[model samples]
Target: MAGSYGAETTQGERYRLSFTVGGLLAPQGRALAEMYLNRMGDGSTERSSQAKVSEKISEKANEKSDKNAGEEVGESIAAIRQQAIEENVLAIRTDSANRRVVAETTRRLSALTVEELAYLAGPDSSTSDREALMWIAMCRYYAIVGEFAGEVLKKHYLTGNTHLDFEDYDRFIADKATWHSELETVSEGTAKKLRSNLFKAMREAHLFDKKSGTVLSFLPSPSLADILRKRADSFGYLPMRESSL
Candidate 1:
């Protein structure tokens, strides 16, 4: 019986190995059958272990690839956000500089005589024309404030018909009220903030009487134009525009 059993075992191992190898090599279906009851348990255990090992290796490779991809994407997003923040900071700085320049120019131009300002407006310059001219000059003043205030200031005083009476000047000031509405529309909050700062500066300079709602027309005003012009002369800005006075 032992000899018979050994012979059966040998035949069964050969049959099972042949069938498995044939299934891998052949294009036709050579499906496994549980005819080899003696080897069934061991064969099943070996195949399951091989499959689990392959699955673990594939899972680990996929996990590593995903982790690397996530890190790269995170770094890219962080770089873009940092660049945007830097650009916004630069823009804010530029805008703040522009506002300061405008405030300084307006303060200086407000000191000019109405007659001196008339050249900016033409002869028969209506209130609207004068205000438009003043606005233009004020804009130009800010644009060039750091470079050319003094020569421009002298030219303004010298070129205009500076003989208009106070009543005519008062009319010019009254016309400026129309500009308030226009300014409010265009600049909105910015205009109001600038106006407040300007008025405060004027008050401190004694250029206006806040209590009586009156403007003092005769105080020798601090002139940014003159200050800029002097600085420009030291830096050789005299060649740009000859001093008219």
Candidate 2:
């Protein structure tokens, strides 16, 4: 499924299940937000600012790259730079474990507003706020994850059943696979990693308890909540009642 972008299913729904990249990359997101702010603050046009930022980020990566590093590291940096150019975000160090940091970061950030990006990078943003916003960003970027959160998690929360385990993920994937051939094409190993990464992200976002896997209390900050509410259907992705907001 390396090049599998996705296709519309029989049900007229398109799903992109290529979420095997990074998981809740808050640090990278913060770094990118700061870089964006720096570039955008220079009174330059958006296009020029993005271009300069991309060039500088690539130069910085090349400068810091180890001279004696292996070919893989060099290639990773090149890919990272290319993704940075394509995504308009600064490229950071390559993760040996996950080489899609820049791509994933830009995708998540694309879901947010400049104000939201600033909040993520600002001094007032707490860990909880960042995590919640990151989860929202992920939900906005990936429709399948958003569907799981909205259809499965929200429904479970409303029904007073908070338990969320691998069984729940398996069932959700199985059900979606019927309407989403892309999901069906994912290898068992890749599917397992996807499930693991989703749970890891949810755990970090404080959506559930790490020990018991039970849904936890979650309420975004007033500002963040306001941002989401302004976006059509954004708040619906979270397992929260509208009246609660």
Per-prediction TM-score to the true structure, in the order listed: 0.21, 0.73
Model 2 ranges with Cα > 4 A deviation:
1-14, 43-99
User: Model 1, which residues run further than 4 Å from truth?
Assistant: 1-187, 217-245
Best by lDDT: 2
lDDT of each: 0.28, 0.65
How much is 217 displaced in model 1, in angstroms?
4.2
Q: For residues 86-193, what per-residue lDDT tens digits would candidate 2 score against the true structure? A: 554544444533346766675666666655666676666688888877887787667778878888877778889998899998999889877777788788888888
lDDT of 1 at 201: 34
Error of 2 at 64 (Å): 34
lDDT, residue 167, candidate 1: 46
Candidate 1: lDDT over CA atoms? 0.28
